[model samples]
Target: MNEWERLRHAMRATERPDAVLDLATVMREGRRLRTRRRVAGAGAATLAAGIAAVVVLVAVDASGSGGTAPTERPPPVAVAPPSVGVSPTSPEPTPPPTVARDVPPPKALGQVIDSGVRYGTDQRVYYLVRVSVPGAPKVTVGLAAGRRSPNGYLTTDLLVNDVEGADRSAGFHQIGYDERSSTTPVPTFGYFVGPAQRIIGTVDGQQVDARLARWSFDKNVVIFWFDPAELAPGKRLDGIIARDASGRRL
Candidate 1:
C-alpha cells in the first residue's frame, strides 16, 4: 500500500505485510521530498506519530503470535506452544548458586513487583520478575536482574540454582515460557518480581506477596488479565516468589 494508506491502517491498528519504516529511505528508495527546514519539521512530526501509532498496532498484531523466548534479553509475551518452544537438543549445563542476600522490604508497593536479586539455599542464581498490571494482555512484563555470569551476561530466570526448589527448572541457558497469563500459586492478575520503585507504596491498604528485589533499569510493564482455568499438565505454578511488602508486581 502507499504511505497514506499505510498510515491510515496503522492508526486503525491494522497489520501491513512488508511494511517499511524508513520514510527518508523510502523517499530515497524511490520517492522524493522538499529539503527545506520547515518541510523537514513537518515530516518529522508525521514520522514520530506514525512510529508511536505503529508500536501499539504492531504490538497488537504480534500479540497473536504467542509465547516468546523465556529470557530477559527481550520483553516477554504470552504465546502458546506449537509456535515458540525449547529445542530438542538441550544446552550445556551450568553450575547453580545459593540464595540472594535478603533485602529489607520497601516502604510501599505500587505497580511494579520486584523480587530483589538474592542467592537461594545454595547460592542459587536468580533473576527478578517484573509485572505491569493484574491482567496484562499477553505475557507478564518480565525483566532479568540477577548476578552477572563470568561472561557478563545477566541470568535469565531459567537458571536452576535460583529455582532449584521449583522442581526441574533449567538455568539461564534454558529458554523462558511466557507466563503473564499463566496461573500462579495464588489467584492473581499479572505479576512481576524485582527491586522496588513506582509500583511500590502506590495502592493503599493493599496486601502484597511474592515480592522480588527490583532494580530500576530492569523494569517491564504489562496490561494483563486473570483467568480461573484448571491446572494444565506440564504446567505448574510452583516456586518461591517474593513480592513487595504491599503485594504488587514491580
Candidate 2:
C-alpha cells in the first residue's frame, strides 16, 4: 500500500465505527467549557483582591496608625480592700446634772424666811425673804442687807432682787449675798425646796460643805450659804449640789 493509504487506514482504525460525530454539538460544548474557564479565572482574581484588602487592614490595625479611630477606653477604677477585725463603738454621752422636784410651803409676800449676820462684817445683816414679782405667775425669793444702829434701829437695803419665775418647783435658786470688794468678801447663798440633808459646793476642784439652815415656819425651804473664805482669789465656785439622806444628789 502507498503511504497515503496507510495513513487513511490508521485514521479509520482510531475512529469508532458506532460513534457519530456532530460538529454543532462539539462547538456548543467547546463554548461552554471556555465560558466556565473564564468565570473561574475572574473568581480567582476577585478572591486575590479581597485577600490583599484583608492583609492591608491587618497591617494597619497592628501599626495602630490608620482606619476608623480606635474606641477610647475609660481608665481603670481603684477599689479599696475590705477591712478586717472588730469595729470600734462610740462612747455614751454623760447626762447633765439635774435637781429633784420639791414643792415649798406657801408664805406671805415680803415675809422673812431666814436671817443671818453677814460674814466679815458685824453691823451688816443679811435676810432671805419671800416676795412676789409683778406680772409673774409664781412667787420668788430675794436677799436683802441692813445695818443696825446703836439704838437697835435697822436700815435695810435690797441686795439681790427677786428673780421672776423662780419658785419651789425649781431645783434651786441662788444669788450673791455681797459684792466682792476690798472691804467686804463676797459670800454665795441660795435656797432650795426639798428634803436635802446637806448642801455641797465645789471650790478649786474640791467638794466643800456649805452651812445649811431651816426655818421653823417654812421647814421645807432649806437655806444654804458658802463662807467668803471658801471663795478666795484664784479659787472658783464650780457648782452647787444638794443631796438627800441616802447621799443621792437631788
Candidate 3:
C-alpha cells in the first residue's frame, strides 16, 4: 500500500472509533480517484490516435490533393481563460544524435487545425488544438474533460489547459490540477525537447511541425503542446474558438 493508504490502515487497526472508519473510507476514495485518473490517461492517448486517423482522412479529402492543406479553422469559445502559462523553452526532450538538424527553421504558415469532435463517446470529452501556422504569434490552446462523479458528470470543467510559447519571463498560468502541485510522491512522467533536434510532435492524427512550449505533469498525467509557427512544415488546424489568433492572423 502507498504511504497514504498505509497510514489509514494503521489508524483503522488501532481505533474502533467512527473517525477511524471515516479515515479508511477517505483512503479508499483516494485510491479510486487516482485509479480513475490513470485510466483516463491511457484512454486519452489511445483515443488521440483514433481521433488522429479521423482527422487525417478528412483533411486529405477536403483538399484537392492529400497534401496538408491550409484553410479556415473553427473558433474557440470565450473562456475566462484556463490558467494558461508559457515556458521558457520547449517541453519535449531533445532529439537523438542520429536525427539531423536544419540551421534555418522551416516556415509554419498554415498548419491544419483539427475539427471539433467528441474524442470519445462521453459527452464531457473534447479537445481544442491550434494548428502550426507559419509566422503566427504564439496562441493559447485548451482541452477540457468533464469530471465523473457518483452524482453523474459535473458540468464540464477545465481539466487541463496551458499555453505553449511563453518564455521564462511569463508567469506560470493556472494548469487546473492543484493536488499534484504540493508533492511528487505520485509516479509521474512527461516529454522533453533537447537542443540540436527539432521538437517534432504529433497531434491526434496530424504530424505538426511545431516546437513545445510547456508540457508538464498535471497530477500524474502530463499536459503538453507546441507553437504552431515554430514547427516545420507547419499545418494549422481550423476550429471555432473564442479569442483565437489563428483566426485573426493566420
Candidate 4:
C-alpha cells in the first residue's frame, strides 16, 4: 500500500492543469498549411515546363549552327562546243576558172574563077572563088577584095553565098549581088547560074558591056562585073541582058 501511495503522490506532484483547445484557430492554421503546400506544388510544375522549353531551343540552335541541316542543290546545265576547222567570219569558197576553145580557119574548095585589079590602082584587087565547109551540103561561092600594105602584107574582105538550090535550066538564077555607091565610081557585080557568052548592062539609056567569066569547074555558073567609071554620075544600072553561044537571048 505505501509503494502504491508514494507512486500516486509523485504522479500528482508532476501533473499540471488540463490544456484548453481553440477549434477556430486550429482550423484556420490547418487550411493555411494546405494552401501553402498546393501553391508550392504548382510552382514546381511551372519550373519543370520552363526547363523543357529551354532544352528544346538549345537542340534546334545546335543543329543549325553545326551545319547538319539538309539542303537542296540545283541541276546541271548543257553547253555546245565549237565546230572544227571553221570560223564564223570566214569567206565563201571560190569557183574554178573557165577554159577557152580554139577555132579553125576557112578553107577553099576550087580554083579562082575571076580576078581583076582596080582602075589605076594596082594595090587593090578583086577575085571570085568557091569554098567547101564541113557541115555544108553544097559549095559556097565568094567574092573578095584584097588590099596590099607597104609591108607587103595583104588583108582580104570576102562576101559569100550558098549555091544549094540554083536553077541552072533558067536563063539566069542570081546567086548574090552587091553595090558600093559610096566609092568615087560606084561599082556593081554579081554571079548567076548560066551558060552564056555575053552580058550587057544599061545605065542612063545607054548600053554598057559587062565582063563575063565561067567557073573552071562548071560552065553553068557564071560571074559578071561592069566598069565602074562607065556609069554616069547619080545613075545606077537599070537592066541586064545575057546571050547564049548562038547569040540567042538567055
TM-score to true structure, per model: 0.20, 0.45, 0.18, 0.41
lDDT of 2 by residue, 157-185 (tens): 32443344444543566444444332444
Q: Pick by lDDT: which candidate is best?
A: 2
Q: Provide the lDDT at 193 for model 4.
A: 65
Q: If both were scored by TM-score, which would come out higher, candidate 1 or candidate 4? A: 4
lDDT of 3 by residue, 74-152 (tens): 5974321122322222232222111111112222112211212222432322223332323322323333323223343
Show model 3 residue runs off by greater than 4 Å. 1-21, 64-250
Model 4 clash pairs are none
Given candidate 3, what's the lDDT at residue 212? 20
Best by TM-score: 2
Ranking by lDDT: 2, 4, 3, 1
Each prediction's number of clashing residue pairs? 72, 0, 40, 0
- Poorly placed runs, candidate 1 (over 4 Å): 1-12, 15-18, 22-116, 120-147, 158-197, 200-206, 209-250
Flag the better candidate by lDDT, 3 or 4. 4
Q: After superposition, how far is residue 232 of candidate 1 from its true place, in Å?
A: 23
The digit string of per-residue lDDT tens for model 4 on 101-195 reads 12122233333332344434434433444444344333344544433344544444334444443222234433223333223232354555666
lDDT tens readout by residue for model 1, 1-250: 9999778556644433235598778778453444565467667766766776677577779784322222123467432111111111212222222222222222212323222223332121233343333332222223232333444333332211122122111112112223332222211222232322212111122212211222233333221111223222123233222223344431
Model 2 pairs in collision: none
How far residue 140's Cα lies from its native spot in candidate 4, in Å, is 3.1
Better of 2 and 3 by lDDT: 2
